[model samples]
Target: MFARLIRPLGLCLILALPALVFRLSGIESDPLILLAVFGTGVVSASFVLAWAAEAAQVDISGGLAIAILAVIAVLPEYAVDLYFAFTAGSRPEYVAYAAANMTGSNRLLLGLGWSLVVLIALAVAKRRTGKSIRALTLDSGHRVELGFLAIASVIAFAIPVSAQIHVALGVGLLAFFGFYLWKVSRGDTEEPDLVGPAATIGALPRRQRRVLVVSLFIGSALVILACAEPFADALIETGAQLGIDEFLLVQWLAPLASEAPEFIIAILFALRGNGAAAIGMLISAKVNQWTLLVGSLPVAYLLGGGGVALHLDGRQVEEFLLTATQTLLGIAALLALRFPRWAAWTLLGLFAVQFVFPGQEARYVLSGVYAALALGAFVYHRRHLLPTLAAPFQDHPDEQAAKAAEQESRTAP
Candidate 1:
């Protein structure tokens, strides 16, 4: 009974956290907070259920999970955009905020999270099994995904600064989204196939699965958003207390907290030796943030008003540079293409260095230098790195199919 009740009760608390935060903040009971909470729960539930379904080898599309996650992830940004669109000067501030959040998040997934996973695996496996890390060979399917993410990141980074230019960028992002979906539909020959519908719904009756699908979808989203609000509020309040920037609070700390769910799921996937699924999910997240999130912001701004206009002060510029530098370091590590125990330690070192240092021009400059060194190391190791590390997980085709079959068989009975 407790097992059955925990998720629901946990979800309830998630829904209530924002209201609790507002109460603590001395703000009056606000309907927006409640609504946001509800939306967050619904979205989070959807993401969770879809993930469960996918893990069970159900026929339900994992794309739905990504889509729901993206939508809910952007809700706060959406709310802010609405506020700035009508009430504020220079409507473009909304777009700029969205860009920061999206780009920052995407880079975190790519440059940091991606490398961390492989590095951890290599280190732990080597320590335990006494084998060197092998190269992750990419078949056609993953090649496509890698290509897609790289292209999207480049495009998102290239969006011109002018408000007028942003409009075109939005349209381009939309087009890319459509093209991506179409490519997915065509199906990559090398990709593992999704679970069939019958198998997916077998665990629940048809009607029950339908209800579960809807409830889980909406409920998950609500929980995620609800949790996000309190999480954000707490971080902001704490950042103020600690004399840290709100941007750092949100970009790094809040995400570390709120995104725990996704990471937990990914870790589970990795532990199961479903490295492809783990990599796929991470890659999907980065691509979605880079293209879908960044792409849609300008469009959202334009619909709300003329367009978003944002100006970065020296402080913000320093922060962005720090983030970008860290990202470049991670990227350099990634381009080395081979996983090594040392790389993990190096990344941990870089991550640690940033936190220990005070917020000053000198500290940021040091960060930039570290990032540059990582990039240089990547270039130095290119021959050994690029060919070896690109795809760290590749089961033989027949073996992979056998694993899938075994997964289906266990789930079916």
Candidate 2:
């Protein structure tokens, strides 16, 4: 009883902390104070969101559950970036900041976030399995995510070439995301392997469990929506007050706050030896950002009355190209449904190159490098590519059928 109450009580306190701070200080207080208060709230909300997602696995297929979790986890990033895009309509100067925030968040997830999860998984695997683990092997069912991500990557490369995002592009991306959700929803359900607060909630009787899930979802969503704007605005204001580059602050600091909770949740999953789910959640997140988040930007701009299209200046163009290429490289690395240690390090090293050489030439060079690596990987895994692409449209199969297919692929000459 005590152990059960501990996690629930702690989660409730975390969820209340930000609201308490906000009520006491108000949004009109110091920028730094607002940042601290709202930021803390977003983090607490993330914990509840994560546990809720884990518990939801009992009601949904693992794939669909992670996909839904990915959507929720990225809500903060969407909140911050969308705010920038929408505000950019009235203040054209904010256009670049919007692009900066989007590109920075995407790169950060693949670079730092993905790499950290992989490393943590490797460490945990070594301890539990009594053998070194070089890579994280994903279930074949994840082909649905990888395939859709690949398609989205191909479409994203066109954004830089076009120099603007049109409403048509937004529709296309949203359509793709909708199709993905529909496909995943039909997946076979499995018994949820729960932990922490999620396990506590999952153990309840049906009615009680559902009530807790609904309560958690509503509570966390409300907290995030309430705090996200203030937290984002405070970051920009604090940057100006401190003489920091506002664009850099929006690009990095804002994402750090919005993304920190998801990162911690993934790390927790990794530490528990559930590396596949951890990586899968992040991969699903990448797809969401690449599609829905990117798609919604132009819509937000238009809703703000910016123009018929959202234009990308030279810097923003470079950022988009770099982000798209990085995504391509990441998808290619996971072509075989495996994320290797060397690949993780390579991603981090390339990401680190930006800070070391912050020049236009470096940006172009990195983009070319990523594109080349991606091409090489796609070519090497050409044999497996077609099947992966077909996975989403293929009929759902039972475990035995999936295993048979896996065996056939391996045994083929």
Candidate 3:
């Protein structure tokens, strides 16, 4: 009893640290900053609790994590963009900035995060003998769904940047939502089960689920908003003082800090041997950012003013292109279906190359390269794609088999 109580208390403390840091970061204490700090503490603790509850159930779903992380991709935009949109009399610029960030974040996740996972799997190949590297098979449902997403992603990219993104984004989001519902309703039986004692574990109680969901929603909102103010402000002030580009500080450093939750959560899931969920959460985050987050910003800006515009100079354009290209590579790498050591190296290579590249044309070229790689990989794995897509649906039976097999293995030994 004491142990259980102590664990939760410790986690609460851990989550609150960010908010505390935010409060202490600046000498000038804005009242809103104070409010954000308090709110963040509450929200972070709630998300931790929700995560714990899900882990306790031994569930490996990625939907919740994806949704939560996606919120962060937009949080920074909303926090700063909204302020400028309302006050600067340049609502269009605010919308443009928000859209750019969302799009950029999505590409980064796909290009960097996905590629890293593939490469990491190879480096850690011998770490676990029980898990299979070729475990990701898409079922027909998933295939159809992913096909839609692929098309949507492509179409979205093709649309001239100046055009309204609302319709495209709305359609893409609806498709994803529909796909998610179908996946969930099919039950989480799409993979081989983990070896464990089934009788001792029980289904999650509704009350606990409610507590977790509510807490996470409220806590995340408050925590992120609170952290954003200080993080963004610090980046601007410190960068200026240090003779660094203020935009660089806010754009890059701030996001890395804000993305800490997703990073921590993904690592936790990976450690638990739920690679699919871990990877899926990151993917979902990209999808939401690319579609919903980017889409909503323009609408918000328009409401704030009659027109929205974000002046993209050459440097900003280059960064945006680099982001998109990276994402294309990551997505394609995942579709490869085999986790080779080289895959990981390539992912890191692509990410590193883009990291240093300084022009939009260069990024655009790399993105094309990424697309070509994906196409080739898909063709190479054509025979296995069906089985891979169907694997999630078949995981239920495999899970039961693994459980039964484990029991027998233990008995025999």
Candidate 4:
């Protein structure tokens, strides 16, 4: 039993070996080489982080477990981006990298992450049922996530409008996260259907399970923290040498590396035909990224350097606008609690095009398109709009959920 568990755990540690060595030995390498080594570390450690997060379900409120897991799973991203935010205090140029990292992760999670999960789930469902699953339907407990995301999306626009990430806004976002956690903590505890290594760890005795979870969180966080600065710098240096745009590289590649675990885990869930769990996990991640991860940037900046806010340049502003709109569209698409095939493909399509035409004008057009679609979706699913936004704050969420379920069944064809 010990050996069986050790195999998977050791595999992840081995994958992260190069980063650990580089950090400790202070090895110097080419920019691309550093990128490869450090990026591998981020990706590998993130897998460990995700497993630890999943195993943590055994220790937390069942309804809130996924959200907490979502938060912990993306800590690699927070480490890397926050490093940039902290550095920006002295090196002002790093401010863009910080914003870029945040926006990229949020966009990648929602646009690519959410869509691919639904697409894979649909394919698997079709294979089993001989009929296409039109959409992935979420459980009522997810209403809290949607409501929090809805509020975050609206507030996110202020970043671009004000052209900065100010302390006050950070406070507001943090407050939202705090309230979200508090609300979720009150939910009834249920046994989670964990799989793979998470299942292995979760099956351990309570005391051992917690100790291991804490150890993994600490170990992976140390690995991520050690690699974060070097990885961010290597990305920029490598981009310059290759004549690729550094901002774009920071915007995309860094996120791709940091969010790899989340994408892989969510994909696995979809492959198991559990699209709702997969999508719900990513949605919760979005809420975390938009609120907690992002909200911490200015704080990190202030602690690293004396700054009241982090200023956003033109490009950063555009990225924030695009990210915010994509988030709103995601919320609107999920308003009816069903992520339809068309919406999946539509989001995937839009996400792809953003890279194909990376320009200010193109960005504005894309943002407008997202807003237009989101507005239309809210109108089309008008009845669900109010309920979704109000779901998190109800005095009796379980009873409300029951009523909603009853109503849904009555309206079912």
Candidate 5:
């Protein structure tokens, strides 16, 4: 009994440590130490959040459960970026950090997170099923997510054109997210296939399971609320102290810290030969980040007394354009409900080029390249694109297959 309790207890301790330390020591004066403490807290809370989400599937429909999970999984990212956006209201210098963090997190999800999922899945598929995975095939039901993403991506271009995130934009995006949740909530429910610590907690008696899940959710939320401000502020201070470009640090480092847990969890799922679930979760997350996450920024700014819009400067404009273009390319690549290896590599390659040639000229040039490629893909796949966009409203074979897969996993010993 003691041995069985160890793993779950360890996870609880891991989830608790950072919050305990933060309460005891408060924010450290040393930026590096502060970063380490709060960052670790965020990562640990992320794990708890992930497990709680999976456990939730036992009680909710698969699509809605995953959607909720995606939102919760990204809470850390939201906390950090929203902090920057809200802070930017009064301190205009902080405006760039808000945009930097948002664009970087969005780009990283596709460039690093999506690509890594396919690569890892391919490797796992070969070993487990003796089948070569040329591409990661998404269920047709994902069309709902991809279609919504396409609409948002197109609207995102308007932000750069206007050089501001207006309240109207926020309203539109939030409306889409609300519709997305409603659509997904009506999807078929399946018994959840729990794994790892989630499985352990889920095996408990019903009342006990419910208690644990609620505890995990409340605990992780508190940890995030306690740590997000310190972590965000420490990152900026650390970059300043190290003489690192604050924009670059906010763009890459902050996201790397906040997004690490999700990346690791998704990769782990792929490695276990559950590539579909891994990619699906990431897809849902992308939608959440693009819609609710982006939409909430201007609202935060407004609440912080920054007026009705969040204004962007030149660099932020370019960043938004680049991020939006990349999103278009990603949707085109997955229009057929497939993520080909070549498409994955293309995303990673283009993302890397930005780091190599960091200038206004390069940003525009790369944006053009992405847009051209996306247009070509859309034109070539025009026939499938319409059907795909209509998929959420119709029954699909892929949805059935996904349901069957879930049933099998859930019943497995």
Candidate 6:
């Protein structure tokens, strides 16, 4: 077991080495070099985080671990984005950077990350079974996530329509997030069937396993905190030097780096034929990003001496509209608790269209298309709407089982 652990563990450390040296050395480096060093470090640490999260289910409560691990992506991205928001209080120009990072990460999680999980899971299923499964069914218990995500998605449209992120709005979003954690905690615990490095770590004795998990979580978070700022700055500077739009770079590249862990971890689960867990994790991530991450931006700005609201310009407003609409479409797609191939392709295709037509007009057009499609989807799954709304507050199957067992035991003569 010790020998088996060496390769995966060593690779993560090695990948992180250059960034650690660069960060500690304090020697000024080229923007491109900094991007590579810090980017690699983030990716490497993300892998470690992935392993720790998978192994965490053994130590943490079952459904609760998913909720906690979903925030794994939030740590670095929030650090980078909040830096921009906090700075925007004084600089003001940094407000656009904050918006770009938030919008980009949200869109990327649903577009690329969610689609890839489904597509790859289908491909793996074809090889294993000699037939492709077109739709991946989610566990019924996951309605808790879908339910909260749906509420968040509906609430998200207010931001673009208002062209502002107010403290009240942020608090509202945070309320939903709080309820999400509450629902997850109320669910009964179950042991996850883990594999790969996570399995190796899970095999450890209880105390040792816990110590290792805590160590990895702390170590990776520190590495991420140290690297996120440098990585973001490097990407922006590199974009300027290369004559690329810094908005595009910050929107896409920064998120690509910070979102790496969640994406990689989801892909791993998908490859293992656990498509439900894979996509479910991404959905949880989207929920947290939409709620916790988005909600925190204005609060951070205010703390940095900005006013009570984070205002968005016209372009940023359009971007938020596009992101919110896309989120609504995503919720509609999963209203039936099944992700189909056509929906996967539709999301990926529309997301790719953004790069081809990068203009304010295109954003409005895409938002319209997304909104229409989402409307259709909701209509088709209309029956599930009320149940989805109530799902978070309802008892989970495991919880019901536990309750019934306890009741019967107490009534025994």
The true-versus-predicted C-alpha distance at residue 111 of model 5, in Å, is 0.6
How close is every model to the real structure, measured as TM-score? 0.66, 0.89, 0.66, 0.94, 0.90, 0.92
- Model 2 RMSD, rounded to 1 decimal: 3.3
Output the number of the lDDT-best candidate.
Answer: 4
The TM-score leader among the candidates is 4
Worst-scoring 10-residue span by lDDT in model 6: 396-405
Looking at model 5, residue 126 earns an lDDT score of 87
Please provide, for model 5 over 234-313, each residue's C-alpha lDDT reduced to its tens digit, 9 standing for 90 to 100: 88988989998889888998788778878877888888888877887788888888889989999998877688899899
Can you write out model 1's per-residue Cα lDDT over 110-169, one digit (the tens) per residue? 546665666555545566668876643223344344445545544543443222326577
| Candidate that beats the other on lDDT, 2 or 4, i.e. the better one | 4
In candidate 3 the C-alpha lDDT for residue 225 amounts to 57
lDDT of 2: 0.81
**Taking the tens digit of each residue's C-alpha lDDT, what string does model 6 give over 217-264?**
899888888887788888888888889999999999888887887787
Q: What are the lDDT scores of the predictions, listed in order?
A: 0.49, 0.81, 0.49, 0.87, 0.82, 0.85
Return the candidate ranking by TM-score, descending: 4, 6, 5, 2, 3, 1
- What tens digits encode model 3's per-residue C-alpha lDDT throughout 1-413? 22343455457668688576756675465544544454456445444533443333334344344343344434544465344333323434333444344544554555456555544443344377755454332222333234334544555553345344444454555555555445544543333232111111213355654454455445655555555545444544565566875555445444444454455555555556565555665665565555555445445555655444333455555555555555545445544333444555666677667558735676777767766776776665454344444443453433343344355456643
What C-alpha lDDT does candidate 3 achieve relative to the native structure? Answer: 0.49
Model 6: colliding residue pairs: none
Candidate 1 displacement at residue 68 in angstroms: 7.1
Q: What TM-score would candidate 5 get against the native? A: 0.90
